[model samples]
Target: MNKSFPAIFALALFLSVLLFNYAAAQSTVQERIKQVENNLTENLQTNDAGPMNLQKRMEHYKVNGLSIAVIKDYKIDWVKAYGVADAASKIPVTDQTLFQAASISKSLNAVGVMKLFKSKHLDLFADINTYLSSWKFPYDSLSKGKKINTANLLSHTAGLSVHGFGGYEPGTPLPSVIQILNGTKPANSGAVRSVFEPGIRQQYSGGGTTITQLMVTDISKERYEKYMSDQVLKPMGMLNSTFAQSPAGLKRGLLATGYDVGGKEVKGKYHIYPEQAPAGLWTNPADLARYIIETQLAYEGRSAKVLDQETTKLRLTPYMNAEAALGVFIEDYNGLKYFGHGGANEGFRSGYYGSLAGGNGLVIMVNSDNGEIIQELINSIATVYDFKGLNKTEKIKLANVSEKDLDSYLGDYQLTPKLVLTITREGKQVYAQATGQSRIEAFAETSSKFFFKVIHANMEFVKDDQGKVTKMIFNQGGRIEAKKL
Candidate 1:
């Protein structure tokens, strides 16, 4: 054989090996995606087998649309979308459809704030009033001689008022950031004032985040949205995200419409959140995966697109609380720590998690008020990928109670002026429907205690000396006592 013939045969063999490896990698990705699609689990499993497939769970939760992105090796392995963007229009959800990030905005806001710290534009431990130009925080006796700092704002340790906001509806005139701070005319929330001594303990304050929003503008001499877009989100390669209260530039049908738990469209499509730092960013799962990937890379000192390795470490470190770090909470699963944040806006629920090591992360967004399915999906993904301790499946057992006992607990329990949890019975099974939420069955675990299968909530029926039901102790994230009304 000629010398040229030997060279040509070697080149052909190299090309064949490359092609075979690429095909094998693609096969692995598709297999993982398929496993996640069919493995959706419930937070509370019952004797009855409900829907487990991805599409069936979406319908079972009455969710109109949802998107997911899984990250591996500091890169997005897959991004998937399911259901409709708008149920009324029958538009299918695509990977590009943006969902409201809600309180998840706080996580990114913390990044922006930390970037300011990195540049020495302002001090995170300095009194926020140092950079605030338009409004001043009213230092009342509630502060107890302590000063509120930007660090406190990010860590929810400032002890400020207003746990969260009820966003304005479409056609309603929006409030300026100053108006929101002062709770002036056109602002629906109360003024952001001190409720207790600063730095004493952790108390959630969306109002405190709004303070940092103004400080950002004051220090940078730029709009909060623009500064974040240019310095934080864009540099991190999150191009499909925005802090616009009204996302005006989006192409038609790119923004997913929000839906209630009952599958009804939210009037005006969605509420307008002018509180950009706390709950205003609109983004999709794929874009959020980039933020997580950047964080993971920077944590390992591998990448520093916006924040250098040192500053990224500061942002992830817990400030005062064990879990409530600067912007995101550090969740310890087994012994591995994962940073995460959850968001809930009107007719929208979303969540994201990034492991401290292994370069592993996942983002999930949904355009429905019912958040029960979101946790269930996380459990399923965590189980498949071995994200230890995130699997929160509690195989619940049902207890049979006498019909008379079940009937005694039937009535409306007034939780708030606007919210009432109504307990009803259909034959022997009891059900509960909270105001503006879908009705869920409340299984009797005991004669007085009942729990829900779709969400991790417990309702313990209380009785008086006469043995008549008087009130209900609703326990989920916290304990709330509601008198039977």
Candidate 2:
């Protein structure tokens, strides 16, 4: 009886051991499945795209291709490219394929100036007049005594009239740097003009940066492109990058053809820009990422390789009550703050935003007039990383108002004496149009504050003594004022 009982106990214990092993294996398999699901989910569906299939999602958004570089853990974790480099070329965009960076060139240009600044060759607050020789600003009575400094120019507070330099068509006669600055023939305007006194308001002026190029040229005694190359690009090892204004852009076959909004390829000959400091840079995303990485390192008080710690910190901080610091815009979205720049020229629009903390950076560039598509996707990427609120939301006035109340507010609100915004109603929606401009859809925040999402700005309506809305204010591009027109 004792021997039989012992055998039964051993058999029962063996069966119990097998059941425990089986349960443990099942648990491990379940964990593996969960990890896989998480990875898949992270790759799919952003806030704007909703839950459609990936292929359909890409096509619907008109994104021919996209390249994303993730900068985290103090280094680039990964970089990926999707879609064709040229839709008709049947050539896929690889990690090495180049994309025209457009206005993002300004950020790189800023780095160049800061390099000089770090060496004590350039002063931020010194009068720009000391650096000029060939061409000069018209300098109306308003700006005669006011000194335009390098810091003011870097911050876009130079009070220049032209917001940006116009790129010439490929076949058109290229303007010299002096010609472009003078706004002469073969150029868009005769000369750069001053709309307001320097340092009075924060207005974006790419022409102002041209003055920086001129200053660099005078100080370095080299062509603008040569100076940038020797001081900035070469030191950074930006092998493929070039100042688009350089003759080398033509020889190296580095220039990308500008496109129209409808995807029609432009046939004009390549036009040269003398004003290389504003939007003349031509480089790829990979090289640009290197620039961004250095900035991040500089912020951490680590070795930046180029700019010193003091100058880099000054460039990152807000200058003159503007959202932009130095060449990039300083903004806080969700809980994370970042520094980067956005560029738009001809058919291209690109933006690169990176977090100051250890999250990845996002760079988006498209050769189409579809700024909306890029902006929306950029916002989506931010949201995916849980960046819920950005400076992107439009502010419109009106609170708890019904559809019936929207009619009274459907009139024009003047932004400035020169700029008038007309508000018209189409069904339940309201559209605002500036004089001599196409009407754009305006999103509302409350009842009094409305903002344009197509660009950066907001509109607020002020009421009169009788509770009647008397005036409305539209704020955009660093210019703010009321319009009673």
Candidate 3:
């Protein structure tokens, strides 16, 4: 027997084992992807909580399109696209299709501001007026004479108003940043003034973020979109991403058209956001995965594509708000930390999260006003990946209420002069439809109390001494009495 025969046999065996392992690993990956697709759960889960198919889930939520990218072991494990870019045009989502980043742009905006601090010596703590040659924040007595800084703007602690923007409809003139800050004509939004003194607490001001948009333009002498494209997005390997309000150079057919909660197409397809820093960005989940991976690597001091280790740490550290860091929000889950942000524009809702350890992350984007699907998808992903403390589904049990009781709660309750909440009973199901919105089913929590799964609100039917329903106490952010008519 030749001695070389034994060696050759050993080598062949090793190669066979390697090939088998690779094939098995790939099979597992496919299984996980299938599980994620087939297991989309509802936030308000019922006792009949069977795992839902992704397409069914999309139909249930009236979402037009969705894009997803999951990161595992510091790399994108998988990327999947679902549904159509536009329901009318029937364009499918390939994920080169761009969706508005919305407020998620603030996350990268923080990176841009920190880059200025690192490279250009812009003081993060100095008065924002120092760098505002184009326009200054009109800090009246509302500011209490305290100065607002770059950090405050990034962390949303500037105490500014204008929670968010409603983008301009088609053919409408876009507002200049100055006009926007002043709430002048064509801006549509109110003046971004101090609602309270600066540095009071965490007030989410896209207005403040817009001010930093100005600061970036003023300091860099470049358009916000161009500067972001050159300095931050490109550097992070997010080649497909842009801060352009109307993203140019994108393929003619790649922009996903917007849709409303009722599945109606946006009149102009999608509104134009001149508020670029706070709301304007057009990118997909794949590009977002690159951004998340780079951030995770930078946090671990293994990479410095856009931010160094020290600056990255500073960016992740909570500023004025415990959960809100510079551009991202940091939440601790049983000692496991994560940083992420969610975004919404006129017809789009998106969210992304990257774990501080283990390099696990997920990005989800949809071209519909309904955000109910996003959280449900996240719950499924969290369960599949065993991401500690990431699932936030609320399983609710329906209370015993007679069909007659539900029907008694039916009536038009005048919430305001022009607004009425019309509660209608269809068969045995109780549905609440606003004046111009779609009907949402309210599950019975008790005899007189009802809760909505789509919207986070509850209503209690107030009965008179005669056991006649007279009013409804609607509690959503605040309690209000709506007299039944």
Candidate 4:
């Protein structure tokens, strides 16, 4: 044979070996995925809340209705609904019961935008200003020439403020979409202005997604909700989901009433998010699971209908310096990497998380303001699956302390620039209330640590340089420091 022919043959042989190794690795992963599915099926059937009384705890924590969906091996193997959808009607919450998915809608909107990316009509990192028609972002002197892209908006790195949209409650005149963007009346939930230069640090801004929605309307010349229905919801078969922004839809009676920590159902107030892309869509756990499965398929290169493999990778990749990726928070929990988003609306809370490595994932939603309870419950269940990177360890262990000492701990503490904690004593017992929240009972877990029986969090008093108790840092959903004010 010629010398060139011999070299080509050697190169082909090396390529064969590499392909063989890759195939073997993929086979091993599939086998592990099957095993995880088996374990989840068994555990869910026999799930009696062993290490912690999860089901009972949900009820005690005033969770009116809850649902869970698990995706394993590219299939939605489990979907379970718990408790009553309507407490008064005694209607059981079934898989079909439509719930306000809240901010979970943002993830779906992000997917819709990615579809535009596949058409080569949208650039994720392009200047958002290029798509604007009605008005441009009022960039400050520092950020006048800076650009905000789809990637920045998705990952919350657009340097915008006002973590998210606050839905319209009853008796409030609904703000127009422009009014919301302008921080006008009825849309005061988030600041209507940018905080820092575009592509700076991570700051949760549903306003960014609102801008995304505006851009979609401007480019497609169609309503945001209609575009989403045609492009994302219909393809995904989310039949029960709706983009309706009226209380009449809610009053039609399939919707679960939002509840507070005390189990008081909230009515006359529903979210009319001008930030439609961020918090507008309402869906069920089943539909949300399907959306998540699509993400998994995209990652594996098995599907490219909505987004190309390269664009999908770019969206999932972190944009800001934070762990939050485009439209979802990405973190290494336990030892496996997970990608999902958490949502909280008026009286409802939901979280969707799954391993990026294709092991398993979970979706949990509760019809209560106390979504932290669901977070704790899911984190506990994840631990059973031996998820390696979960940093959630905050728990409630109540202790009976002398009533007199309660007075000493009673004081106002500041958790953040926005969060304030007020401690009040009644006899030997101490009750705590955060700003804008009703008073709650704080049971002593230890002499130093106390737990909020309603929400899944604990407060521990910290001493200052004088050792006279200057601060009380609360550890619950995450670390939050509260200095005595």
* Residue-by-residue lDDT tens digits, candidate 4, 1-485: 69799899999999999999989977865654444333221112111322445566676678888877767667776677888777877887888777778888888888888878777768877888877887687778656578778788888888787777668766668876777788877767655577778776788888887888887788888888888888888777776777667424453456766777677777662455556788877777888888777777778787765676687777777776648787777886455678888888887889988677774677888888887566565655465556556435543445566654466677899888988899988775678888997888776767778876456688898766765778888888798877788
Task: State the lDDT of candidate 1 residue by residue for 93-185, as single tens digits.
Answer: 999999999999999999999998999988989988888888788898888889999999999999999989989999999999999999997
TM-score of 3: 0.94
Question: Which scores higher on TM-score, 1 or 3?
Answer: 3
lDDT of 2: 0.67
Ranking by lDDT: 1, 3, 4, 2
Greater TM-score among 3 and 4 belongs to 3
- Tell me how far the alpha carbon of residue 466 in candidate 3 is from the true structure, in angstroms, after superposition: 3.7
Clashes in model 3: which pairs?
Answer: none
Return the lDDT, model 3, position 386: 93
Model 4 clash pairs are: 333-389, 333-390, 334-388, 334-389, 334-390, 335-388, 335-389, 399-444, 403-428
Clashes of 1: 0
Native-to-model Cα distance after best TM-score fit, residue 287 in candidate 1, in Å: 1.2
Kindly list the per-residue Cα lDDT of model 3 for residues 1-485, writing each as its tens digit. Answer: 69799999999999999999999988988999999998878777865777788888899878889999999999999988999997777889996888888888999888999999989659999999999997777778978889999999988898999999999987889989999999999889999999988887999999999999999999999888899999999998888888886777767769999898889999899999989989888889999999899999999999998999899999999997579899999999878999999998999999999998899999999999988888888988998999888888777778878877787888899888999999988776889998998788988888898888778899999999988899999999999999999
Q: lDDT value for candidate 4? A: 0.73
TM-score of each: 0.90, 0.71, 0.94, 0.76
Task: List the candidate 1 regions with Cα displacement exceeding 4 Å.
Answer: 1-3, 48-51, 400-424, 432-439, 454-456, 460-485
